[model samples]
Target: MTRLFNEPSQFADELVKGFVAANSQWVRPVAGGVVRRAPTVEGQTAVVVGGGSGHYPAFGGIVGPGLAHGAAMGNLFASPSAQQVHSVAVAAENRGGVLLTFGNYAGDVLNFATAEARLNSEGIVTRTVVVTDDISSAPVGQEHKRRGIAGDLTVFKAAAAAAEAGYSLDEVVRVATEANDRTRSIGVAFSGCTLPGQTEPLFTVPAGRMAVGMGIHGEPGIAETDVPTANELAELLVSSLLAELPPSIATAQDARAAVILNGLGSVKYEELFVVYGRVAELLEAAGITVVEPEVGELVTSFDMAGVSLTLFWLNDELEGFWRAGADTPAYKKGRVGSPSSASTAASTADTQSFAEADRLTLAAETAASLPTELPDSSDASRDAALAIADAIEAIAEVIDEHADELGRIDAVAGDGDHGIGMQRGSRAAATAARSAALNGAGALSALSLAGDAWADRAGGTSGALWGLALQSVGAALGNTTEVTGSAVATGVSDAVSGIQSFGKAVVGDKTMVDAMVPFTERLSREVNAGGDLVTSWRAAAEVATAAAAGTADLLPRMGRARPHAEKSLGTPDAGAHSFALIVVRVGEVLASRHSEFA
Candidate 1:
């Protein structure tokens, strides 16, 4: 199974049991299965929150002295029932009554509303606060329709403090609503996730590609495009938030804001900070002053690979209550800053560039001095190597068509998109190689240019590895005019060794090396036997194909997909499959060009 859990249904029960057991000082279980009841302070109203599980420390972990008074939890990425919400509220409710807050989802909306009615019928007053902070969920005029995400913490803290300061349920609701009204959040996913015990993830995000508006759970997003750098991601998120936030809120109280950079698990803290650092830059550029910046797992989607941003518009009263001290195991009170008394001067630098005025001027004299071809044309082996490189470039189109399928395969056992990344890299290599060939550059020059372009187009562990292979092959055949079978064998052997050294994967590790090893072995054997280049490469392609198929029996021992990396006992490695295809197509091209070598 792809999931790391033992039993799917029992996951919720076991996790909740452990949570309540570990946190008995502040939390207790409701009579039903999911909700964990947490005690609120005396003279303070109760703050009730509920949402699906998996996104922990969120709906549940925040239940404490200064945050949520109680939390109703559900199965992984599933909503709690009305009964679960009511039961938890019963335990959490004190003399001040309960203030209900939850993410805006249909299931959560219905279930929490039903629980509110049940509580009202029992003479226990309750007020509701719904969080709709995701900017992609609705347009500016319809902000109420957005999804509540990392912004929940801002709302919860604002509401919890109101209740702690002895505000009535209605007033507590008002404070939280104000916070939610001014809040905006947006997220991007580098990859998607799986629920416990599920063989397949709910959806797949293509590798090296990112979905801009990915929901907290499995809901689809607005757009998918090439993955942007951390700086680019920060700009996109911050700019969108600035555009969507209320004008009054932006200008209110010196336009001060609280920025929360939340990691949805799997993403390292270092990467989160890299993104956060850029977010601070963009926010400052937009004239938005940030208060205490929060960076941590305030919310998560159980090993989901993504990050989100939330902005809370700060007001005087909310600021005062936020600064008030509170004691909780998972949460600590934040100190509010004194409003800036001085007017700061901002700078205006023109950022537009003039591209046409900056063209390089290379003289015809220098161009004439450069070699049109290599110095020597004696070695037939050099031509054979060039022939193989040319053929690999020719068939890049077929690989591009299979990008979607490769992504699907990756989604099954790894971050889907290996195919997309490979196709993109291959096509770029082909274009670069073809351009150099058309310019009449020698074999090594064309191959070297292709290798560099491949690396530039495909970024990530595997892409860089494959680019290394191409670079090694290019360098091995450098300045050689004619190519032969032995020279081709030497280039393949060196390229395989270089890629292996960099990737650090041995045979049976379920990586590209599995296919590369056999292909190089076949090439060396044919060279020693004095066979033609076509016959040698064809034999090598067959070995590569068999080695790729043989990888199905080996378990994955490398890459980030290790923990849940199941025994891929019947499927070929995506990298290995691509390598095998390149080998076969290159061999075919060599067979048609035997006269050139002879």
Candidate 2:
């Protein structure tokens, strides 16, 4: 469980601030995340790596001369938005092209691919090599389906080293892709991690048992069994990886590989060393040689009692790149160069008086931006906008009631941050909607502002999708119009279209689309039949509730749940359930204000 935090929603922002203050010598604050304080060589391709926070020394902690030029940090267990990645790419561009590399997750894929396209349109050459190295996530001959874990380090290092050696963007991407193709990783956890301010763990391992193949974001394991002896555990890990050798390795014998024994948060150094001892013997017995193996905590989930093993098969070129020097804030190898100017005694001469103020100013400047200008509105529109605020209040209240339960559902096969993400997004949306309504904004402007706040504050797939839904609705009901049942129904239908297009999920994907599609269709039919807003919403909410409940019998075909599809059976899709829950509450709110759209 998490204990120390001022505000749960602000945890990611606060930690980044503290990290920059302490590691100013290696990194400086950027709009989205962090970048190296030290300058880089001219015309060197920039390597930008990032994902969600909580996994330290992965995204931000590896920003340095011989590593990534910048990192785009996201909320805890959530991928950074496309805008966040773009910000970091812009900051790191140095006349050469940009290479974005990170773990392969659904949100990260959507966000980073969007950023890559955006950068290309602006005449900046950008490419990506998504790391998919976790052997347990997918079966043989389906390596592309695997997710990245501790192996993120290997791919990021390969790209950075290539860039440091002045490789072109195309060559850097090639090297990183090859590194990812060769890397294999597997992880196991003794217990689950708890999110900040949460009362319980996302999912728990039974006492005297261990979970195999759990994800860093608290995704439940694919298999669980009684705890094994240290030697037995090492044998399991080693044998599992050995069964699926990389295509680059013709045989295991006499092959050299870069090895990493990663401790996920609470696992200590001595324990890792003990595990590595047996791992080394197993490799030696098979005639496989290990080179420059790292045994420590590199990538981590906050306080997760787990360990992961990564093997990066080394060819001649890869071995050279793997041994390259890097000097980040957390992870370090051989000396990259002289200490950065930020670390000089001269720079620290006045550390007492201005440090705290500087930190505060940096945090303010780095905060995510929100929309400010409100659209034109009339008196009637302003009155109608009040309903939007009331509806958001109801949504927030319902989420507050069932957040823990939503987390549990998500933990069945997902990262288990759905509840926390929704809590932050809804609270921010409610505040924004209320302020907009009070300030004379119309339904269009009020809802749009709230959408911006939700997406910016929450920073996840759910946040982005929900924000898009609000914006789509608000766009349909432009300011200064007479609000009607037909208009509201049309808005929801438009939202369904936009969400499907943006998220690339279809009706039977076992996502929110399953329930949202039904709700929108029913609402459109009811409105077409001359039903009032309250009546139509109530009818739609009922349909949504049943559809959401029906998702329990289906297997997920999209997002994080796809890898652990079987584990998610008998549990409703958290996104669908939350969406249905919100609409049901909104229907109740509309019933009280039934005369507004009459």
Candidate 3:
């Protein structure tokens, strides 16, 4: 278990501070993440890669010459917000467009894709290539859904090498995409990891057993077996990967592969080298050629006692790129050419100014998209805004109260971050809503600001979805003089519709949508029957609560939970439960102190 932490909530930010301080030669801090500290390279396509924070060398550690130009670091096991991605991209100097790359996860996909759209709209010409190289996450013919793991380095390196070689954005994306297609990885864990301040591990393996096909994110392994000797374990990993070579290699005898025997976290280099020895022997016996194989920690999962193997089936072009040198904080390869640098003081000042300019530009562009001024509202509407603010603040309190339970529920089949993320998002939303209401803003403006705050502060799939839901409802409510049941029902409908459209999750997915669909349907029915908003909301909240409970019997069809469908069967989705809880509390607020708004 983690022992040192100022605050579990501030861990990600605090570590980044120390990382930048120690590695100032390679990376400097940006608003959301980090970019190379060296001089700017005009017109070079910036290769920005990122994911959750625990994976050390993966993201921020590899920000330097011949590697990722920037990395959008997220909270522990959470994807960064779209705004975070955009800020890092802007700071990275997008003269030749930007190539966004990361592990293929739901949250990362949504957030990065959103940032890509925004960057392209700003004429930055951003493109994304999701690394889907882990063979365990999905089966054959479903490779697109596979998660990226230790193989992230191969894709990131290929793309960054191409970018440093002055390839165009399209070409860089192509190289990364090809690298992802060629690479495949699989892992096993002997023990699970504990997040900071957590008393227990996310999941545990039985004694003397190793969980096979485990994920880097605190997700439980797909299967378990008695632990084997180092050679036997190596054979398992090597044979597993060898069985699923990319289509380019027809036979083991005909192909050369770049091997990566990666230690997850606590696994020592000596232990990895022992495994790699057997892995190399197995490959040689199979008549395969290994090229520049790596045998140490690459992508770690906090303190997970696990290791993974990656096979990058190499062609001539890929071979050249693989051999190319890179100089980052953690990983270093052959000699690398350095970019021109300004003196320490001058460079710091210049880059700080550049980052600020980029930030201001992005803020201006975003402001153009959102309304700059709050709408004029009647006294009644302003009064309703106070109720909205109070309801949100109440949600924050409730979420905080149940955060630990939520985390446990999520850890059954997911990354176990739902509670932390929800707590952060709800608190941020509440603060924003309260401030807007205090400033005499109407319901529309208050909720909209709250949504943005929730999304920005939380930075994950749930965050984005909840943020959009609030924004959609706000749009439907507008600045009407009086809040009516019909208006509330319409807003709820729009919220559900917008969430479905943005996230593409439907009912029975075991997501929040499962509860949301039922609640919205019931609320619309009651409102159409001429019921008051308070009564309709209470009825809807009941339906939602029941629907959330019912999710326990259904297998997850979406998000991280889908991977361990069986493990999650007895537990309701954390998202659905949280949504139900919040709506129920909001109903009480509307029914009690805010009946006039209701």
Best by TM-score: 3
Off by over 4 Å in 1: 1-3, 32-43, 250-253, 334-598
What lDDT would each prediction earn against the true structure?
0.69, 0.86, 0.87
Residue 169 displacement in candidate 1 (angstroms): 1.3
TM-score quality measure for candidate 1 = 0.55
Tens digit of per-residue lDDT, candidate 2, span 1-598:
7899987767888999899888777777776698877777778999999999889977899898788899999888998877778888887889899999988888888878888998999999999999998887778888887888999999999989999999999999999999999999999999888788777676678899999998887665569888888888889888988888997788999999899999999999999999999999999998998989999999999889999999899999989998999888888888788436645553445454235545664566544354456678977778878988999988889998998888879878888888878887898899999988998899999889888777756667888888889999998887898888898999999999999998999988889999999999999999999888898899999999999999999999999887668878989999999999999999998888766564
RMSD of each: 24.4, 3.0, 2.9
Cα lDDT of model 3 by residue, 235-282, tens digit: 898888888878877888868889999998889999998888899999
TM-score of each: 0.55, 0.90, 0.93
Error of 2 at 530 (Å): 1.2
lDDT of 1 by residue, 7-29 (tens): 54456657876776565444545
lDDT of 2 at 74: 88
Off by over 4 Å in 2: 218-226, 346-387, 434-442, 563-570, 588-598
